[model samples]
Target chain A: MVIRPIVSGFPPNMHKVPVFADHLMLAQRFEHPFSQELGLTGFGLVTCLEGEAQFMINDQRLLLNTSSFAVINRGSRLMINVDETPARPVLLFFRSILADVVAAEIFHRQSGHDKELSYAELKDYRLTEYVHYTHASVKEVLEQAIQLSQSCASFQALKTDALLRSLLQSLGQENYQAIAVSARLPVVKQSTRVDLYKRLSHTKSWMDEHLTEDISLEDYADMALMNPAHFLRNFKTAFGITPHQYMMERRLELAKKLLQNTRQPVQEISEQIGFDVLSSFSYQFKKQEGLSPSQFRKQVTTD
Target chain B: MEESQWSKFKLRVNLNASVEEAYRCWATPAGLEEWFLRDASFKDAAGNAKDKNTLLQEGDTYQWLWYGYPDSVMEKGTVLKANGKDEFVFTFSLGCPVTISIYKEAGETIVQLVESDLPTDQGTMLQHFVGDSKGWIFYLANLKSILEGGLDLRNKKEELVDVITA
Candidate 1:
């Protein structure tokens, strides 16, 4: 294993958390404490900020080095033996209720829009089914929140809470997407055939930038330098759906991201993402998302 | 041509952490909540769900929760080989019709989360592919922050707008 320099220690008073809280200083030459213990319902998220160590959770064992983050969820039984005698593990433990509260509030906001009976006719998916983690931009915001938490600044705490909400909503969107797909519910509209083929010739970054615009099949065909009918047939031949379905799916995706990541009013969000008519936006969102905008916002607000 | 197939999205991440740490983060509960989400349970690779703390082994069926969708664990293929500390390949899925690949690079872990094998009939799947990738970008950012003594970034609505707009 490589020897990386240790950077810093845990946030002060982080150990004062209600759950199990402890800090250990560890280095390569130091010996570790070994034990087979079943922990309480609250588990710590342990990170080897620096140095090296080995930990065993149940039958699974792993070596923790610099920049490593591990969750010690509540109700877990594990054995630990540090290879590097003085290796330090910065641990933060909170009750399972914390996670539950986070999940419930976010889920409700993301999923609450489906109370209407007509909602039942819509598919069951949203936006999260396809992702597991977020990007650096989000992480940076989170880091800012933690830094803010340190000062007890009202603005900072507000900032932190806001960041947390965004992150959870992002997760909810992913979860919704997964459910929609597995239930055989229709997601990603079928009208985007031409755009799909055209995109095959483009890059992801480019498509992401242009997702919320007037991307008609003919326009996409022109962009690809192909005749409209030929583009249609070849696109169908390659992708299987029509150009329009493809566009709607892309639109739906943008809408989902906006719904999960932003608190913009439903009407503004609808227009920002290219839905010209509020009724059409609601109708299409219902068809693809299975929830109304207000319900989605309300559910996410709990976080 | 099947018109009802879902799309696939793939994301590659190179983390500053070790492979084992990354693996455990994905496999264990403590590690999952960092980059993944607050909800990390087990399920079969083929959509058959498994209970929490279920021993994860090659061929052990398991599924993972990704928002509202449950991940289907594909066949636990071989490690493709592990370099002891740095690099390893493991099997994870993107629910019903997609496959995912994870790899590690340098001090950073390169996770290639892929959701593939959707219908080719239209851009439906590919549209999903792009959108999901965008989502992954956000998740990966959150993961990096949490692991690096940063914040969880799970629920920052205003900041999210700032990031999106900026």
Candidate 2:
């Protein structure tokens, strides 16, 4: 009957209804960055809308920028941190019962009922920890689910049931993509390939947080706990792009956003994205965007 | 008019576009056509038709038609308030007032819609309260998709009937 916030509360006294369709889907928007060690009760999709945030889950520090999101598993302790610049994050937490039901449905449909025997217990939501981009359908459906979380709406529980199913289904697809993406590594064992891919992904996330710096390949290899040659080859194989190429892509993406949004000069924006020389930044920007940095700014402002 | 408990509801969507773009989507006749209506025409107080690109004023009366529906199914209403930017209020179904608020929130532009005041009889309650709420949710989602991703989720195929899309 009562709703309590996750920060500075005894515990989140969220809905615990019995039915899966009536499952509790609660959303909490954090106005400012927070720092606390709290245990999660269900899957929490943490999205950084404005600023950067650090989520420590299962001893891994995952940095979420505006372009990325992270999923926190149930029963995992999370430590959220934000610096002087505040990060606005929205968390969508759903009861495990909802995920379990969706998982059962997915498995039952995948394995038709003509089987001779059936397992009494269905699979639970044991999604592995990972960070993903906002382009995922999970993010889209999460936004839809958030709209129904309003207090004044009726049949919210009924409405959210469909969103939950789609969200879980999207997560299932994401997990499948994760495995498929890891298959890019030429390792003989699939488990080794997946584990190596996760490490490489973690390294890439670290570079995302520190985009403005000139990080060395040795440092990335060290962080990923692999030899530099091995890391470079596997990173290229798993992601289909070398680390440097991926870094440049992300840096330019950030540069375009800065150029369009802020009044910063071209040189300043160029340096902000880690281009030591303004000329090279402009060259790269023009190559990727088909327009010069100043030209892009002018086009945006005029439009 | 007796105000019933279930006559009004509010919904909002965070758009990837700017506040100016969000306002344009709901304020002008041509703007409404971009994401919402198939055709929109606004007239001044003197019954003169306003320009399609003209920003709607507070006293303007408007007629809007949808894409899938017939031209006979026009919605006639008057603009209640228009600040030329960021906010718009207009009369909607059954003369109910719909308020639109657009502002920057957490680095994204948000379009907040509140539709209120309706005849709370059984039929009107179901049509406006439940039906309109559900309808606005889809429209707002469609608006976000159109603005953010340039993908219109509307069911533009006239051959298809009984769809819940735009």
Candidate 3:
């Protein structure tokens, strides 16, 4: 274990947050893959902030990219594999008492009341190992923890506990959101529903960002690590729209924006929005907007 | 007299960006508008206004407004230390100084803020220390998000009142 200096340079209050909050944080840049059995006694947060890594839990392999975070419950058999790519993954181990406090806060905030909640009822698959797209706040703190662990000058512990506390709270909220999204999945079992939704949502966000590029269904399925058929079926089931239809809607939105905002030619705009042929772009645009691209541009300009 | 109320706090965040870029985010008015404010203007000691993209200098006074605020709602303060690199200091309120330091630690750029000399009265403690710290938390997150290629989280509409990003 390599211990770095972080505490000496920081003020007393600045250094005590994660330590006093009771989270043991570890952040390192892996030069090579280290495959080791992760003996987690408490809840663990594994984040691949940069590059990619893979984890094996319950005999299932889960890949974590920059867009995803993995959570492991206590006593879970976990193995992490870092690829040859340089990856900086931060690991945080925290006690159950803190997790309970965070879980309680989630319920309190959700109900909009300061009501007492049962721990057993609250404790569920959030404790199990699964990778999902992170909540923004959780991702923010993970960035902090990565630096805190890296900068511990001469700590009693790399305690970013205050930061970790907020992180656990965010993590609980993420689970709640996952549960909400799971309700949309057509799968029978609750856990399966949530898992399928996570995988599909993860792919959908990435796909949305790359909508202007020409990407095949095979590539999209490969990104989700599912066969194209299963990916297509579950994607529609979870999101209520087929990938093609969703892409078309999003592309039309982009097309309209470009047409209204820029003087770029319609043919150029069609190619910019990923249409291979101008005729199909015009057809889709006219169907969606009730006017051709040039007509839509003229109407906007006049109005 | 013993200090009975909390006057100030320190916030530290690690951004996945360069020290130079993080410094630019705080030291330049254009960069400030990119993440933190609807408008930010700085004037030199002689009351000469600086260019929008110019780096602030020590003793330069600044006016800042937020995204959801009208131009009438603004903060007027003075820059106390501007190193032109990774260190900046400005008066957040008349008696309060907020110093920002940017550096690299643990393979990430760390931006640290120390807000000191706050008004120690109960109302100010609850409002300035409590309320203002909440504002910093969101802006810091916004700064990180913008620099890290995530969505710009600021609520830009003037009518979007009471949002954390605003």
Q: Which candidate leads in lDDT? A: 3
State the DockQ of every prediction.
Answer: 0.01, 0.03, 0.03
Residues A1-303, model 3: lDDT tens digits: 122222222234423223223355555677766665553335666767678878776566878767777776655556677875788766666656667776676666667534434445355544235556533555666664454334321110112333465566656766666555566666688666656765776687667668899988899899877999999987887667888889899999999899889999999999999999999999998898899999999999999
Which window of 10 residues has the lowest lDDT sum in candidate 2 chain A?
A116-125
In model 2, where do residues sit more than 4 Å from their true spots? A1-69, A72-128, A131-150, A153-173, A296-303, B1-166
For every model in order, the TM-score on chain A comes to 0.34, 0.59, 0.60
Instruction: Give each model's whole-structure lDDT.
Output: 0.45, 0.69, 0.70
Model 2: how far residue A177 lies from native, Å = 3.4
In angstroms, the error of model 3 at A284 is 3.3
Count of backbone collisions within predicted model 2: 0
Query: Model 2, residue A38: displacement in angstroms?
Result: 10
Give the docking tier of candidate 3: incorrect
Q: What is the lDDT of candidate 2?
A: 0.69
RMSD of each: 25.9, 16.0, 15.4
Model 3 per-residue lDDT tens digits across residues B92-126: 74347899999889999999998888767554564
Model 1 lDDT tens row, B69-148: 11221112222223434333343321223233445556566756554654343332433344345555777666667766
What is the DockQ score of candidate 1, to 2 decimals? 0.01
Better of 1 and 3 by DockQ: 3
- iRMSD, all candidates: 16.2, 13.0, 16.2
